[model samples]
Structures are given as structure tokens and as C-alpha cells.
Target chain A: MSINLTILGCHSATPRANAFPTAQYLEINNRHFLIDCGEGTQRQMRKYKVGFTKINHIFISHLHGDHFYGLIGLLSTYGILSREKELHIFGPKGIKEVTLLQLKISQSHAKYPLIFHELTSKESELIFEDDKVTVRTIPLKHRVYTNGYLFTEKEKPKKLHIDNINHYEEIDRADYNNIKAGKDIVLSTGEIVPNSELTLPPKKPLSYAFCSDTCYKPDIIPIIKNADLLYHEATFLADKTDLAKKTKHATTKEAALIAKEATVNKLIIGHYSGRYKDITLFKDEAQEIFKNTKLAEPGKVFKII
Target chain B: MSINLTILGCHSATPRANAFPTAQYLEINNRHFLIDCGEGTQRQMRKYKVGFTKINHIFISHLHGDHFYGLIGLLSTYGILSREKELHIFGPKGIKEVTLLQLKISQSHAKYPLIFHELTSKESELIFEDDKVTVRTIPLKHRVYTNGYLFTEKEKPKKLHIDNINHYEEIDRADYNNIKAGKDIVLSTGEIVPNSELTLPPKKPLSYAFCSDTCYKPDIIPIIKNADLLYHEATFLADKTDLAKKTKHATTKEAALIAKEATVNKLIIGHYSGRYKDITLFKDEAQEIFKNTKLAEPGKVFKII
Candidate 1:
């Protein structure tokens, strides 16, 4: 199994000229999941070619305008496009109220089933599960009720090559089935075929944890530990740590600390303050503690191996 | 006095990628007035360089999201930018409730005074007047309670060439002021200066009528007649006349018909349907009926003559 992640936006509460607000796309086993849609997210999707129409599940982190302002517009566009499939959204308790009230006031109704799951942010639990993947909310600490998500791919079945099985000489049908089921086999015609000779081992299940928009919260370490790829909000540098605390945000050092403690394979930090013109300083600050840290720039993709 | 009109968004309820909903920038004298703020308007402003921070007055057409989705995000951004100047917003009865709910929900308390001017939208009356311009709402027909604004510039006084008068002969302050004020030119030396020789004719007061997101209503003709610039929505092609009537929208032909009936100096039609790949067809169609028709594309400015 293989999974890929795309960073849609990475700016903080304030919008900058180049950077957009918070949003990310995670593709696990061919299924696309959207996380923490911000203002202008649809435009970002179009610019990045994220294929929003195929996306069904959307996860919003919190109620901040930078987080959920684009949801209503996107929802309305989907309605105009006459989307018949049910659209699922997982967010805090107030998300439904906000969306419904806006829809009520505007006198516009959605043509699709807009299923909303308002999850409480106090606990970490599985929010969505399907045949291919499972998603769990990573409880976060912020001024508002916020939660992140972990998208983990399900284990792949033991590998089987139909051509290789057919090519095998004098192999019994039952023995071939056993070998395809990850068992060493001896044919009834006195022939033996090793499992590796017939089929290779299944690929590793990939897990992408989006600690999407949270301050420095140590409580989420247990849930997000050892994630193949982790994206966190580093809204400020260490020199402005005081400002981050005052605004209930995270500094680069704090974000790196979380990544280092959780043992995340790769740490992608973003949501930089617009005051700093050079974003490379953010990566430099984060790399001091977590050597695998990198800054999330727009139009760039990070691969998780 | 002159008023420069720019089309921010000209769509009706539907929003497309190239064509935004309903938003316009009316610059009368030196003040900027915003009418019908739609969703993604700030992004539109950024893309078109609308200079939103300089805007003081905002007039919303109705409670539709296309008319006012960008308000909350713009207001929040204004607060973050530390803008302390008071912002005046004019809209219908339900507008205050809608904006206040967004602020309260997001915990966005603007440091600036966000004054609300709730227009009854029941009749035509002067809603605002300044030293340079006067604003009146032209009641229109729509599915919801919607109104358009008539932004007319105040009359200008005669322009006196002080340098010409001083270079030609000695002129007293009293005489200069009198000539500039359109009074009989009298001098202390008993030599009356001909007003024609010293003063030039003042430019005509430029007027712009913003009529958007409204059906082709005959009631608006008298109110917007002979406006230097009139922006009417053309949400569909003439072939979709049935769909236009069913949805309470207007076709390009209908929009041109209204402009022709009102005898507006310049007619700009926009709010195109996404189904139409090219909007040049709209311009061609409208120009076939109304000679002075133009298309309202983003980043283009039209000077009121």
C-alpha cells in the first residue's frame, strides 16, 4: 500500500500574499481526504489540482475563520454542481450550527447529504473507518475546541501473482492457494515452491497523521507518535515565543519539540507569522531540535517514505 | 466631481471561478464605497487590487451569501490589521443579525466601530449623503428582499485659474472668491472681472447607478435613468429565458432591454452563467440591442462620463 500527502495551505490566522491559510490533502489507498479547510481553499484546490469533486469527507479543525470560512462557499458550489453523493464533515460541535444558520439565512439548500459529525475535542477516538483506511481525531489544546486526524491505511492482503502461479510446474491447486495465502508450499507432484519465489511480501501500511492546527500540546504525543508524516503549525519563531503564548499559538521550537518527542519520521511545519519575510528561518529554528524538520511552502509536495 | 466605478463581482446567487457573485467599488470624489460584498470578495479585492483598506462604506444588497459572504472575513482581517477607523455598513433588516452572529461565533470583536445602516428597502429614499456624493436605494424585484444603490456625485463649483488672474493683473482675494463662487466679479479698484475670462466651467457631476442581482424590473427605470454608468446582471443567455424566469434571473437580452429602456449612458452586463464558456458572446449579444453595452471583467475600471 502507498499513501501520499499534499499541503494545500499553511498560513496562520492572518492571510499573507503568498501563503494561504490551513488546509491539507491526504491520499491513502486512492481515497482523498481534506483536512482543515480555510479561506480560499477551493481556489487553492483548483490551483493545486486536488480534484475536490472526488473528495467526499472533509475535516475541519476549529471554528476560526481561517479554518472554516471556505466550507460554506465550497458547500454551495457543490450544491450548484448538483452533487448527489453524501458529503461528510467532521468538526467541533458548533460547526453544524454555523453552517446551518448560514444556509438558513441565505435561503440556499444543499442538493447533497451534508453529513456533519461534530466530535468533542476532549478525547482521542476513531472518527471514520472504511474498508481501506481508518481515521482518528487527535485531541488538541487551543483556545477553541479543536481536533486533528490520523489517516492510517489498512493492511494489504498477502500478495499473489496469478501469472507466477500458472507458470509453476506441476503445482497442486491447494498448495498454490496456501502459498498465495503466505504459507510455504510443497506440491503433491513432489515439487516445492517457496512463498518468496511465487509472490513478494505485502507493502507496509502507511499512516499520515495531520496534527493540522494546534498549539504545543504534549497530550497528543501518544496518538500521533511514529506517524510516517506529520504536519504541525509553527506560527512563530522562538524570538516571538511570548506572542505565540498570548495568542494561544505555537512557536517553531515548540512544534519541533512535539515532533521530536513523538518520534515522527518527518516533520512539516507551517503557519508562519506574516511579520517574518523569510520563511527559511522557520525551518532553521525547527531543525535545531528535529533534524528532519522542513518548512511547508505553497505549491510544494513532501513525500513520506 | 467624478465617480470611477469598478466591478468587483457581478454574479447573482451563483458564483463561478472567473465571475464572482455581486460586489462593486464606487469611487466618488476621493471616497471609496463598496456595494454588495460577495463571497471570496477579499480574494477578489486582492486579485484586482481593490484597495479594501481604504473603503469606509459598505452597502449590502440582501441577506444572500453571494451578496455578503466575504463580510465576516474582511471584518476579521480589518481587526487583525489593527484598523481603528469606523466602518459604515448599509443593508437590509436581517443584515445586522447575520453579521453579528458571525462575529460572536468567531469571537471576532473589531477594534473599530462597525456601524450598521439597516435599509428598509421598501421605497426609494436617500440612504446616505456626504459632501461629495449622495446614495439612494432603488427598490427592485427578486425572490428575496433586495435593493440597488444610486451613487450620484454632488455638483461642483466653477474652477478659477488663480495663476492666470494673478499673472494678467492684480486680483484681490475677495474678487477671486466671488468669481469662483459663481457670483458677479467685482474688484476693489471698481474694475469688474468678467467671470468667463477668469473662471472655467466646472466639470459635470458624475453619477453611477449600481443595479445588480435583480430581475428586469420596470420599477427601477426612473430611478436609474440616464445614469453615467449602470451595472445590471445578465446571469443567462437569451436562449435560457425559461430558466431565467423560473429562477428569477435575467438573460443578456433582458438586461440590455432594461438598459435601453432606462437610456443609461453606459450599460455594463455581467454575472454570467458558468455554462457559457465564453463571455464575449454576452457582450456581442447585448451590443446587438444596446449600443453602449460592456462586459464587467475583473481588474477593469470604467470612468463615469
Candidate 2:
């Protein structure tokens, strides 16, 4: 399985002419998800051509304006579009009340089923799961209650080795299912063909970790360990460590340190503060600790093959 | 005196990639006001270079997402910028509860005083008034309790007629204030000059009427009569008259009819439905009934001189 991520918007604080706040589209194992919808995120999704109908689940990191202000507008747009699919929202406990109040006051006709999974736990826990994928929350430390998310692809069944299966005429099409199920196939001549010899192991499952709007917390490292891809918030550089600490946001070095400690395969840093004119400095600073660090830009895509 | 209006966003239903929802920046007699803040209006304000801090009053037409979803985000941004000025908001009754709930849930640190003038009156009534300008609600017919706004510049003091005053040697600079106040000039010889002869009347007060998401209602003609400029929602063309009626929206012909009957100097038709690919059709249809008609476009400026 593969994971594709599209950064719809990634900037800290208010949205400017060129700088957008935080939002991302993650497509893992054919399932589409939206993460941390800031203001103007719907427009950004339109600009980036994110499939609107495919987004059935939305994960909000926190209730901060920069993180979840776009949720209401997006839901209203969905209503205008006459979306019939049930939508699931995962966020803080107050998300349901705030969202429903707006929808009620606005008299929105979004009659579709909106299921809210309000999160109040301060520890990592599995929040979403389906046949193809599973999502877990990584509780994060921020000025407000927040949670990161981990998405993983479920293990697939073994694949039949065509060349090895053809070696014996007794290995008929009927026996292929048994070999693919990791079972030994017995031949009519009383010989046993091991499943490992007749079938190949399935491809390794991929996982993506999303952490944003949080202070430097090493406790989350173990939960996101060895993730194929990780997106961490880096709102400032090392020079502003004091400011970062005061604001409860992470610096580039802090994000890189977390990435390095977690041993994630690749790290993507975003949520750059508007005070910084050059975003490349964030990548440069993050790369000092993690060589595979990348800067998150609007419309930028990261793929794990 | 002049009235400057910038169309920030003027579309119907939902905000699209290129088409924005209803939002306008109106500057009348040096007073700045933001009218109908749709989602992404802050970004649009930055794009069009609308002075953010100058806007102390915001008027929302209705609780529709297209009308006022961006208000929360803009208020949050103002808090981030450390704005201390008290903001006045005028909208429907439930606006206060919905807006305050979102702010509270998000823990927005906007300590600035947000005064809400809830409008539940069915008849036209003045809502906001300052020294330079006055705003009134034009009760509209829509699916929801909606009210359009009428912004009128207060009449200025009379202008001194220098050429006419030059003819009289007794008209001294010390008496200029009386002349500007439309008082007759009294010379040292006790000879009285008529106020009309000593001073010229101030420029006629300019007014703008903003109507959106409404059906064809002729009763509003008296409320918007002889407006300097009128922006009326035209969500559909003549061919889709049934749809417009069903949706409680107005067609181009209906908007033009209102402008013509109201004797407005200029008419701006906007809130075009997404089905209409050629927005020029709206202008053409509107121009058929009203000659002084313009299509509302993002960043388009309309001036009443």
C-alpha cells in the first residue's frame, strides 16, 4: 500500500494573501481523509483539486482558529452540494456543540448524517478503523487540548507466486486459494508444497503520522515510532525557542529532534510562523537534526511508495 | 462627498475556486464598513488591499454560510493582531449566540468588546449610526430571517461660496463658520445677505443599498428609493425563474426591475448561480431593464461621485 499527502495549506496564525493556515489531504490505501481544516481550507482544497466527495472523515488537531475554523464552512458547502454520504468528525469534546450551534443558527440544510467522535482522552488510543485502514490518536501537548493522528494500512493477504505455482501440475487453480492464504497445499501424490515456496509475502504496510500545533513532547515518539512518513509542526526556529516555549509551539529543531527520536523514515515540517519571510530556513534548520526533513508548502505533495 | 465600494466576493450558494460568496467593502464619507463577510473574506480583503483595521463595524445579511462564515476567523485574526478597538456587529438575532459560542469553544483571546445589534424587526429600522454615516435594515423576503443593509452618508455642512463672498467686502473670514452653517451673512453695516447667496449647498448625501439572497419584493422600493447605488442579488437568469423562486432568490430581471422601480442611479447584479457559465448574460439581461447596470466582480470598484 502507498500513502499520498497533499498540503492544502500550511502556515501559522492568520491566513495572509500567500500564506494559508494548516490543512492537509491524506490518501492512504485508497481512503481519503482531511486533517486540521483552518480558515480558507475549502478554497485551498478546491485550488489543490482535492476530491471533495472522497473525504468522509476529518481529523482536527485542536479547537484553535488556525486549526478548525474551516470546518463549519466546509460542512455548509457539503450541504449545498447535497452530499448524501455520512461524514465522521474527530476532534475535541466541544467540537460537537460548536459545530451544531452554527449549523442550527445558520439553518443549514445539511441533512446528511454527521457523526462526531468527540475526543477527550489524554493518551494514545485507536479512534477509527475499517477493513482497509486504521487510525489512532497521539495525544499532544498544546496550550489547548490537542491530538495527533496515526494512519496505518492493514496487512494484506499473501500473493501467489505464479512461477513457483506452475512448477507442479498438481497445483491446480483450486489450490491457489490455499497457498495465498498461507496454507500448505497437499498434492495427490502425497507430497506437500509449503505455502512459503508457492506464495510470496505481501508488501509491507505503510503508516503516516500527523502532529501539529503542539509543544515539544518526547512521549509521543514511542507511539509514532518508525512511521513511514511524519508531518510535524515547526512554528519557529531555534532562535525563538523561548517564544516557542511561551506559546507552547515547537521550533524547527524541536520537531526534527522528535522526528529523529521517533526514527521516522521521512519528516515534513510545516505551520511556519508568518514572521519568517523565508520558509527555506525552516527546512535548513530542521535538516540539521533530521537529514530527510522537508518543508511543507501549499499544494506540495508527499508520497510514500 | 463620494462613496467607494469594493466587491470582495459576490456569488451564490457556495464559495468556489474562482467564484467567491457575498462580501463587500464599503467606504462612505470616510467611514469604513465590511458588509456580509463570507468564508475566505479575510484572504480576499488582503488580496484586494482592503484596510483591515479601519473596519470597526461589520454587517451580516443573514446567517447563511455564504454571508457570514468568515466573521469568526476575521475576529480571531484581529485578536492575534492585538486589536483593541471595540467591534460592532449587526445581523440577525441568533448571530450573537452562534459567534460567541465558537469563540468560547476555540478559546479565542479576543478581549475586544464585540457588541451585537440583533435585528428581529420586520419593518425597516435604523441599526447603526455615527457622525458620518447611518445604517438601516431593509427587511427582506427569504427562506430565513434576513435583512439587507442601507448605508447612507450623513449630510455634510454647507460649503463656503468664495466667489460669491468675494463680491461683498464686508464678508470677513471670522464669519465663515456662520456661512458654512447655512446662516445668512451679516455685514458690519448690518446688511444681511441670504444664506443661499453666501454659501453653496453641500454635495448631496450618497447612499448604497445591499440586498442579497432574497426573492422579488416590490415593497422594499420605498426603503431603497433613489439610492446612489444598489447591489441586488441575481442568482439566476430568466430561464431559471422557477428555480430562483423556489430557492427564494431573484433573477437578473427581478433585480433590474427593483433597481428601475427604486430609481437607483446605478445597479450592481451579483450572487450568480454556478449554473450560469456566462456572467455577461446577467449584465445583458439586467441592462435590458436598467441601463446603468454593472456586474459585480471580485476586486471591482464602484464609485458614486
Q: Tell me, by TM-score, which candidate is best.
A: 2
TM-score of chain A of each: 0.89, 0.97
Clashes of each: 0, 0
Error of 2 at B63 (Å): 0.5
In candidate 2, list every pair of residues with a backbone clash: none
User: Stretches of candidate 2 above 4 Å error?
Assistant: A186-190, B166-174, B186-190
Tens-digit per-residue lDDT, B59-157, candidate 1: 988777778887888888898889989999998886777677777777787889999999774899999898888899988767777888888888878
lDDT string for model 2 (B242-281, tens) is 9989999999999999999999999999999988789999
Q: What is the interface RMSD of candidate 2, in Å?
A: 1.1
DockQ of each: 0.35, 0.76
- TM-scores of the candidates are 0.87, 0.97
TM-score of chain B of 1: 0.90
Local accuracy of candidate 2 as per-residue lDDT tens digits, A1-305: 88999999899876688988899999999999999999888988888888899999999999999899889999998998899999999999999999998999888957999999999999899999998899999999998999999999999899989999898987788877777779998878889888889888899999999999899999999999999999999999999999999999999999999999999999999999889999899999999999999999999999987
